[model samples]
Target: MPTETSSLELVGVLDELTPEKEKYSDALKAAGEGFVEAYNIFQDADFVTKKGWKSELSKDDATVHSKNLSFGHVFALRTTLPVPIDIAFRESFLNFDDLATWSENITFSKTIAKLTDHVDVVHYANPDVAVVQSREFLVARIWRKVDDDIYVSARSVKLEHVPTAKGRTRGHLHLGCARFSPDPTDANKTTIDYLLSIDLKGLIPKAIVNLTMAKIILKDFTETKKHYANVLASENAQTHELEHHGV
Candidate 1:
């Protein structure tokens, strides 16, 4: 049973949270329009601009085409959070075992094998993709913690040999990882860069893939920005409450 005073305090916290949301949205809008290109390395397909999050999309065979083969580079930023670098690195990128804790896109993840202390071979399923009238499959990503960032390299693993209404197919490996480090200007804030160089493989329509390519690519980073904003806002609110109560 909560008291009226506590309820009033909760409402006040929401008030603080709402304004922070607006601030974070503005920051992300600016980031999408600026500082996006600093993450791009691939010359041809790198479409990332400072306009939030971006990805370059293409197919191996455009004509006589199948959605089975497509590859590109993706760049996204998780910014405007005042969390420390180490915490940001762990929660945003390193903590794969509990990925569903922070990432909305990844619904479930469990460790299939532990290669070492820093590396986790994982098998994850995405129900989000299954509902799209698209070919569904299981993904196995290798998570390795580098010096300052975590590297997540994955390929489509075979859930089944033949294609079925519910079966898996072969996939390829894309070499790149998200890097994390301290912000040069602000010690309290952290910057996150997600660089995905993946060749998405499966059976689907090339036209469909091309049509929704930008949305699919941007989905990863869009979630990242939202998660980042919510994380810091919640933290700031807690800090405010503590000070208000003289705790």
Candidate 2:
């Protein structure tokens, strides 16, 4: 949501909001545990493309891999964006309320509650794909800076405020994490690693689910890369205008 390089300020806001921990203890705990689990998965080289993972999609420098887990099949994607890490972090993690505007797969997204500056209770829906039914998620999301990288983690949580909508199946997000880091070689580039596992709780066929899951994720990240490029171009144009006007 921030237009400037203010990720550190976001971290400060997280620290200042620590006093409210007691109020949202359950949600925070669930979200934090999800973060830790996701971080471990991201750090495990064997859990990624190297070991049991089967390559699902790989094109234009974006790659997705899948492996069977106890809860569901998990998908991990890695890609580089032509935008800085801060911008990628803001758009992908902080600005979820506006996700459906640019993301084609998501039909709607809303921030039900802001537990903290870095944590939120969010609800979002995806339209039916192929034989899969429309699915929705009620999740607790938290994002923070760890070391020099930014991580956003989300896990499904039951809340009275969010109930399943008519004709839509609820999806349990076992674990979802997105990591954003500087590309090292280019200041204007960022590398992102994403991991997700979800169980759509309904009478859907496993064959169809598996067939469509990887393609959906591939489209999601491909759209994300394009959206980030557009955002960066728009920002640069605005900066150029300001400089031309000597503002």
Candidate 3:
């Protein structure tokens, strides 16, 4: 009994689809490109999700199938910074209390907040249901130290829902936590692992959901993984210099 008209609007809309699926392949490609660009800009940024409802076409009278459009998948990626156990304990423990300070001082925190705001604006303009959710501070519940390495786990969530006719819904839900630990084998190294499980439901096709999920994960993983690598490299370089100087 939902409206028949398309209630969802994509932040980045696809051009006209050709009758021939092959000819319309470009649409999918374009969507992929745009997703990557937007995702990179907003990932790790702090933001909020806003929700509301509006009327659309009556479901009973509509003839256009909702399947023809593309709504991207949902995913999550996390970065773990390697800190000495003592430092980790201090940082993780103080994260909550220092959240305000972190937001004011950390460059990444500011970047994340900006990204979330951008996503909100984009989603609002496009009209599809989209949300950006982030924790003010990293939550550390699980901590393990193997050899010289230390591992810590944290959690967060993001959800997007787009309602359609035919009792179908298209959206993305990303959940799970990330684990970060020092590299036992490397004295100057750290390892980070991010695990995210995805769930999609409603009248949407399984195939489409699966594909979008993959794309979302791929984009997020790549960007976050790269960020971690950069942080590790910087830490390693600093550690080496200190040793050389006998600090």
Candidate 4:
């Protein structure tokens, strides 16, 4: 598994939106949709051609070459829970295979097919490394490394439901590991040292195409974060009141 580390220290009310285990389970579905949308943008012929990514694929066999490309993207999302929240609840969602599937009619590419064929899903839940599922599958496992360690893996699929308040939702998928570091000072305000690396095999050298796709994924997450933040704010206020009253 490929790994990179970065620190992210969330501030303001954001710091209190600690994720429960169930939240990760819910987010997995949303993350999957984000991943798919991002992949489509990356694979668009016009977008690829305009950005010079087409050159990476064999001109004589664009489909074959494109099909063999190893490009993959992963996303790690973290939210801080209030002090009173149970960590066990948060860890429950670490088992990757528990994610909900948004659709049964989804199609995958050859490259994705190959990776899933060898994919494994394991979580550090206890004495046993729970193997939720294995074999070639579109979405890999969800994992929570030992005590704030970096979690790395790749996945492809959308499982989480998007909030209705966000308006009509778009399909987006996330295929990457979740890295968590106990330290602060990471680039993305992540408490757990984390890195969402995207393998730019066929898309490398096509800087424009790669960047455009990256922007789409980042933007989607940015908006998603806004929605999460809004929800968190309300929750935090309620919790604070309960705490003040010793509830």
Better of 1 and 3 by lDDT: 1
RMSD over all Cα atoms, model 4: 17.2
Q: How far is 99's C-alpha from truth in model 4 (Å)? A: 11
lDDT of 4 by residue, 1-247 (tens): 1111111111111111123333333234333333344434433574334432222221121111122124443222233322112222233223223322211111211221111211232211101011211112234333323443434344444324412112222222234443444434443233321123343222225454344334433332343334335545777899999999999
Weakest lDDT window of 10 consecutive positions for candidate 3:
117-126
* Overall local distance difference test of candidate 1: 0.42
Error of 2 at 106 (Å): 1.1
For all candidates in order, the CA lDDT equals 0.42, 0.79, 0.32, 0.31
Indicate which candidate wins on lDDT: 2
lDDT of 3: 0.32
Q: List model 3 lDDT by residue over 1-247, tens digit each.
A: 2121211124333222223323323223333334343333233233111012112112222111111112332233333344443444344322323423422222122111111111110110011222322212211122334344333322222212212223333232222223345556543343343333334444546665445444434444444434445645787899999999999
Ranking by TM-score: 2, 1, 4, 3
| lDDT string, candidate 1, 1-247, tens digits | 3332211111112111133233222222222222222223312242224333322442221111112213454433333456677666656545666866666565555654433333333454433443243323233333434454333333443333223334543233242344455677877775554443334465556544444433444455556556766777888899999999999
| lDDT of candidate 3 at residue 221, scale 0 to 100 | 43
Candidate 3 residue runs with Cα over 4 Å from true position: 1-174, 200-202, 232-247
Q: Which residue pairs collide, candidate 2?
A: none
